[model samples]
Target: MLIRKAHSGDAQRVFDIRNQAINHQCVGHYPEADLAVWTRGELSDYFIEVVANTGHVAVIDNQVTASGLLDLETGQVDAVFVDPACMGRGIGRRMMDYLEQQALQAGLSHLILDSTLNAADFYRRCGFVGERIAQYQSPRGLTLACVPMIKHLAR
Candidate 1:
């Protein structure tokens, strides 16, 4: 597996992985209506631009299997997703590890993120703890439950 910064051209691949994970992996945790709203245009062209500017992706044998983003200014991790087919392969952990390293290098002492309900446990295992910060609402007012979490890094 290769982990590296994402480029603009890689946005579509990243978007696809996000959708696959949401569709296949999150169905049990969310309503089909909510899932439809969440995946539809949630990963947009503008989002791709942001990922290209501030995200990382994991590639296995030339295919993007996972993606994440770290915002240096806010010390926040964002948009983390692994392909459903690649689940249980430690790809998410690896992506988080890489993001944390990048945050530390940028002199951040902590990292924050809002995780989908389905993924809160994964963040907990990675040493983040917090609570349901807010209900993320789409433009149309559709909601996806999320937990706000934070992790303090050791100096």
Candidate 2:
């Protein structure tokens, strides 16, 4: 497996992972994402517009299987997802390593993320301590649900 900064060419694979996260778990969406939910151009636009420091993707067997973003704002880790087929193999941990490296290099002292109900344990195992009763500021308003987790980078 290879991990790298996402490029325009990675639009499709990232889109699939994102949709899977949305549909299968609350790590990404409240409702399900339908197939053909977004066009290639739309996905690219989203990558550029919302993924924070662009995006990071993990490719295995020549296919993208995991993805996440380092949000410059608040140093929040966003959009972390690994294909369900590839779960239980530590792919998510590797992806977190990539995101954490970026955060540390950027001089960020903390990495924050909204942990899905199903992913709280995973995040905890990744060394993220739960910031219970936390709220996330979203476009809709402040999000008050979900387990908020944080990993402090050693200074």
Candidate 3:
């Protein structure tokens, strides 16, 4: 799998991956109402902007199977998602590694993310600490329960 910076053309695939992951993997973790609200949207313009800026995609066999983003200024990692069909293949780990490396290269000493309930353990395995319950205010105006996690990067 090749992990590379995302471009505008990757927006749709990234969006699809995110929704698919959430819809499939988050079933027992989130209420159905929350899931419906969260997944009720098409490819968003904000996603396009993110892809053009801080986004990255993991491609295998020329297909985008995962996506991630790192906000350099805020040391915030966001939008990390893998297609449900492509899970359990270490794609998520690779994406996290890529994002963390980008953060380190930008001189960030720590990174934070609001992880979905289903993804908290995965982030813990990635060396992030903190499982304080948090409410993530989505851009679409949803208040979703999430785990606020942080990791101090090794220099």
Candidate 4:
């Protein structure tokens, strides 16, 4: 697998990976209404516009299987998603590793993320300690239960 910075052309694929994870892997952890709202693809423009310049994607055999973003200024890891079919294949881990490296390069001491319920364990395994900090309401007004997590980067 190859992990690299995303480009403009990878937007749609990144969007697709996120939708796939939410619809398939995350469905059981959320309510039907929430899933419907999330999978409705409302963040299309943001993914298309900002992801390319600010995110990373994992490629396997020339296909994108995962995507994520690192916010340099905020030290936040945003929108990390792996294709449901590609779960347990270490793609998500690789993306997180890349993001942590970026954080270190930016001289950040820590990284944080608001992880969905189903993904909390995954984040924990990547060295994040989290708690139920708040409920995130989507633009469509669906409430998502999330855990805000933080990881201290090693020097």
State which candidate has the highest lDDT: 3
Candidate with better TM-score, 3 vs 4: 3
lDDT, candidates in the order shown: 0.87, 0.73, 0.92, 0.86
lDDT of 3 at 93: 97
**Per-prediction TM-score, please?**
0.93, 0.76, 0.97, 0.93
Best candidate (score: TM-score): 3
Q: Kindly report the root-mean-square deviation of model 3 from the true structure over all alpha carbons.
A: 0.9
* Model 2 steric clash pairs: none
What candidate 3 gets wrong by more than 4 Å, as runs, is: none
Off by over 4 Å in 4: none
Q: Rank the candidates by lDDT, best first.
A: 3, 1, 4, 2
Ten residues in sequence with the least summed lDDT for candidate 4: 41-50
Give, for candidate 2, the lowest lDDT window spanning 10 residues: 31-40
Better of 2 and 3 by lDDT: 3
Cα deviation at 77, candidate 2, in Å, is 0.3
